[model samples]
Target: MENSTIVPKSSLDFLTQLKENNNKPWFETNKPKYLIELNHIENFAGALLHELSKTDVLETASGKKSVYRIYRDIRFSKDKTPFKTFWGGSYTRATKERRGGYYFHIEAGNSFFAGGFWGPNAADLKRIRTEFAHDTEPMQKILSSKSFVSNFGTLQGEQLKTAPKGFDVNHEAIDLLRYKQFLVIKRFTDDEVLSPNFLEQALETFKNMRPFFDYMSEVLTTDINGASVL
Candidate 1:
């Protein structure tokens, strides 16, 4: 029952309790514990924000903007759980207009640091695919680097069954072109998340993602139709 957590040690205990009692009354009773962990995450978010700002990735970063709600949107779900078992958040680009950035997530057993251009719109996807089609080397260099591959296995996302209309089936970068979303993750275990060095490790992982983000920035920040289209 003692928490010497400097930066969000773990909500694992509370989450386990929530999973067992997944009801309003139980949650109401445990509100204080939830708030304590929530504040821990807020502090973690603030530290992450500072780290990101150092690299100019997050412009006007705020812990409030970076942290996500613990409650789940259960309106249309079959399970209909009122609260989530984890906490997470996103750090948008310093430009504010840029569409893709970084994400931090913490769950009982599935903690990870993720980032990239997730689910880009049709127009944005086309632009990026076109860029890859013409010059795949730049993006390929980043994805294939030792640090990138070690930190993030690969560009993880949904892909189309067939190639887009403008590209041929035999195109060299067809695989990259077929991607509908560009997301990547670096996972961590429960012990790792609670470690004193967790913040340092998280920041380093984020640093490695810079090249990939920089590549996306070219398209996402390009002035198209008089506005930046992520």
Candidate 2:
């Protein structure tokens, strides 16, 4: 196992170059450099996974599997950039019972770690909304806890302008009911990303997400009666 746990300077430098020369020709010429950086990132991810698995089960098979492709699909977008200028990835929790996911992004000035339900299907959305409508205290407690506040600051994601159909606009939990997505994010500076203990710090930050994750997981896996759905 590779012992180095820091994000290499070369990786960031290469990404900076890639941002300037995002065309196919420039990328083709610099493929070897990219590969080297990718390897380092893969190893870093692998190490992170190894630590993460000690506390949580993950569906992602390996660090390499968690890394997102640098390629950008521009099939219908105005921004025709062929490649991403940063390293990004995610890990999904294993099994139906475990809800939420973890994500990491490494970039020059905009690196962050985030986890939550980016998208909940119609059924899941309704379920979460119903739970919040009935009782927002549980979720509220998790969001307001000191660790949660210190780490992520607050819950974030898209929200409806008004109440959903069948939900009263003046509902007590209307703020919670308006959510279209659920996410929490923590940012890090470039210097922090390159630090030796960044891996451990990342793990701790992820650990702080457990209260929110566990709450959501329980809400998701059980029906309104609190019986197991899976």
Candidate 3:
């Protein structure tokens, strides 16, 4: 694993302060510290990505050589800290159009990571939804796996089974929409992210779940024929 510095408490505090000081000239005043933190996060993300790449798990799905990135979308939001509360990383096969990335939620602490195919546009969503519905059993099996279930919380999975909002799982396409992406959601609480043993456990969990991604990759690459899909 590439070397990473423990994200400093002072750094997080400064970012929180910057977010609260809307009227003040915080950016100009704290330019150096801000730049340093940004760089530090970038390095940390890169290191984490390197560690992930060492495993052959993310072959076709992740699409890019450099997996980690900080999301740069900050429009009409109350939180105006220049730095992000999270960093994300992922890879995909060369054939895929774009990189598949996952988030490291900082507010929930950084060891946690969640990833799956996301529908940025209508066409993408359509393909994913179609595939999800086509091979429901296999998809459900992976989602319900002990390892996978642990990540999303058992209660959340049961809730998802009922479908979203007014949607019913008994409905045809609508009910199956949530199953479209092969999401591998893992949680690392504050203690886990901050602790070495917990962090190691988290990484091992990612490694163990690698097979599920492999299964999804195979299914996605296969033709739409229902029998051959999963």
Highest-lDDT candidate:
2
Residues 25-55 of candidate 3: C-alpha lDDT, one tens digit per residue = 6567877876676665555555555566677
Error of 2 at 141 (Å): 0.5
Top model number, TM-score:
2
Clashing pairs in 2: none
Ranking by TM-score: 2, 1, 3
**Which should have the higher lDDT, number 2 or number 3?**
2
- The lowest-lDDT stretch of 10 consecutive residues in candidate 3 is 153-162
Between prediction 2 and prediction 3, the one with superior TM-score is: 2
lDDT of 2 at 78: 98
Of models 1 and 2, which has the larger lDDT?
2
C-alpha lDDT values of all predictions = 0.80, 0.93, 0.52
Position 146, candidate 3: lDDT: 80
C-alpha RMSD in Å of predicted model 1 compared with the true structure? 3.3
Query: Of 1 and 3, which scores higher on lDDT?
Result: 1
RMSD of each: 3.3, 1.1, 5.7
